[model samples]
Target: MCPRSFTSTSELLSPEPALVEPNAGNSHSLRANRLLQHAIPPPMLPVVDLDPEQVRVLGCLVEKQLTTPQQYPLTLNALVSACNQSSNRDPVVSFSEEAVERAVTGAKARGLARFVHPSHGRSALRYRHELAEVLGLDERQLALLGVLMLRGPQTPGELRSRTERMARLDGLGEVEAELSALAGREEPLVRRLPRSPGQKEDRYAHCLGSAIRHVEDSAPDEVRQRDVPSQSPVPAPSSPAPGAWSEELAELRHEVARLRRDLDELRSQLGA
Candidate 1:
């Protein structure tokens, strides 16, 4: 939820009751928290579908936790800044603290994130993602999801280089195998996109959410709005270049063909 930030270190010693602490000692709270932290049992792990902003918010938490542990439990200001950071982000954003907070609230509900009180004596609220436990992801999967959350979609080669520290994903084949596992899960964690015209490899994206947008160079006046995170209405689709209709069309055709093949396989299995 929208966690609080403290201005004085003195407040840490005698803090008010935490409205949303995940690790309360009480058995009931602990049990409830456990349920939320882990996916509902087998045969029904609900797909962690989320909005674009929630995706970004979760991604930011994971990234900061690994890359900037010193600043792991981010303050509201820091969280906002991380979410809006230009580097390693797709469809860059200018989200407000309120917007980020809203996304945090939504993320918490989905059991993919958590809000925390001050850490190491600081008297401020902080947030983190519980994706590793909830999704049963290894370090490799966590790294892959983090990159996709921050950067939208990317090829296996790109992921291999970016996920160096989070996991041992140095080879393209290694990355692809991991992606295939994620995509093949009963509740698929990721999905593969059709190849773009100029791109040699298909980009993979987290099915949880996306900030895709359609841009037109010839028609500057046409401002189309796509869906964003729960907090902010403005989406993060990196504005595509003009005259890319051909690419879009080709992608659609490829997708249709792929679906057809899958359908044929299903039919064969059914023996109809």
Candidate 2:
């Protein structure tokens, strides 16, 4: 298959210009896109089922690209630091370069990321995420996904707070609007998790793959301290509602789909 074209990393690193509406001349491109869409079958679309490590790696790439543009295409060491950074990340992890490299390779295979060589006198290869382009996400959508990937499930308010560095989410409404857009995609990328007992808001999580268990535990300590005001401790419920398990079942189905894809790829490789 031909490589998918998207905004180049260099272009992303450049200053943004004024937004303009598409002109009539671009109609040919739109027609081509529609024709290509019909030409490709649903099964031919790449399945996005990133493991937790891959999620963190891709999240770091997206976050760094927007937040630290001067160092957008991160080197291996830099990406490692971003992924393991004590701040911002929930359930802080210490991933080795090898682990990160493997995740990067997985993401590349999924067309969510790519490797690049740094310009100038530098020689080390760098990496950047193509998620925004591949997923057709705007800045707000990318910000929410990045935060969800890094921090795990969160309330809309929490997302708005954390994504401030990456996008301007004026209020919970804007966040919800964008979240709705993401969830409404043909292949949804996000889902709203069931509200826990005593919680006033529903937490949202990315549906790229299996859930990250550590993040499912609770909000980050810093987030709790900063955003969640202290309140009386609420007792844990004995059991969840019967229907609450439906979402979890769906998540398992996603994992199964990913496993099936992997098995198929292996069979193809072995020519079985």
Candidate 3:
């Protein structure tokens, strides 16, 4: 559906049903959207069945909400920017405005998005995701989902690192535990993908739908935290070792001690 481009933010917020007046130059076919206004939202759609575009649109909304709440409920133009961003996305895309709007419409039909009227005196309409509410997901799950949907499959180690700014999955173990919890759900939100060719670690793909097309990795499949926009697997031998962790902590402690000594010397100089 190309989202019969029309203006009807009022329909979404109005208390009572009203005839949807299509925009000038549009047709009555757009009137059907009125049903979505008063309609009991459709049942939660399975993330696995969503099309790649739908997944991307929904994920962008969730990501923006979590990462930049001040800019939540993104306008169509802003949303288009997010969908086309090069970073933090797998096999980056440049979806056209029409394509993104259509995807947003598909997501709304699935009860995963909402249309919001212009706010703060802004004239253009804005939209928001109902992803968390529809999926009944908590903050942690939402964070993971947003990343998975935006970036495609990832390993537990990757998930833990990338989600640092969003959730509290302390380490690989916690990431695994949380993944298990999500997988255990009645409609599993995630699944372990069969190991990619030569991949030492099995990656986890989200149920929000598979990538539009399989994207083969160019780099040798090493199970470790990568510099990519998404997931991090436990590092291989070349990756930092556990002892390195202690050494880093030790360095931090030494820095603190140095600062303390410096403070004491300054205090002595001041005759305190």
TM-score for each prediction? 0.62, 0.63, 0.60
Among these predicted structures, which one has the highest TM-score? 2
For model 2, how does the per-residue alpha-carbon lDDT over 192-269 read when each residue is reduced to its tens digit? 776655679998888878554333444455455666677998998878677878888989999999999999999999
Name the lDDT of candidate 1.
Answer: 0.75
Provide the global lDDT of candidate 2 against the true structure: 0.80
Highest lDDT: which candidate?
Answer: 2
lDDT per residue as tens, model 1, 161-267: 88886778758988999999998987677878755545799778887752332112222232222222246567778877765877998899999999999999999
lDDT, model 3, position 200 = 77
Count: clashes, candidate 2: 0
Error of 2 at 165 (Å): 1.1
Model 3: colliding residue pairs: 157-232, 158-231, 158-232, 158-233
Q: Check candidate 1 and list the clashing pairs.
A: 53-229, 211-237
lDDT of 3: 0.74
**Where is model 1 poorest over a 10-residue stretch in terms of lDDT?**
213-222
Off by over 4 Å in 2: 1-46, 212-272
Worst 10 contiguous positions by lDDT, candidate 3: 1-10
Error of 3 at 168 (Å): 2.2
Per-model tally of clashing residue pairs: 2, 0, 4
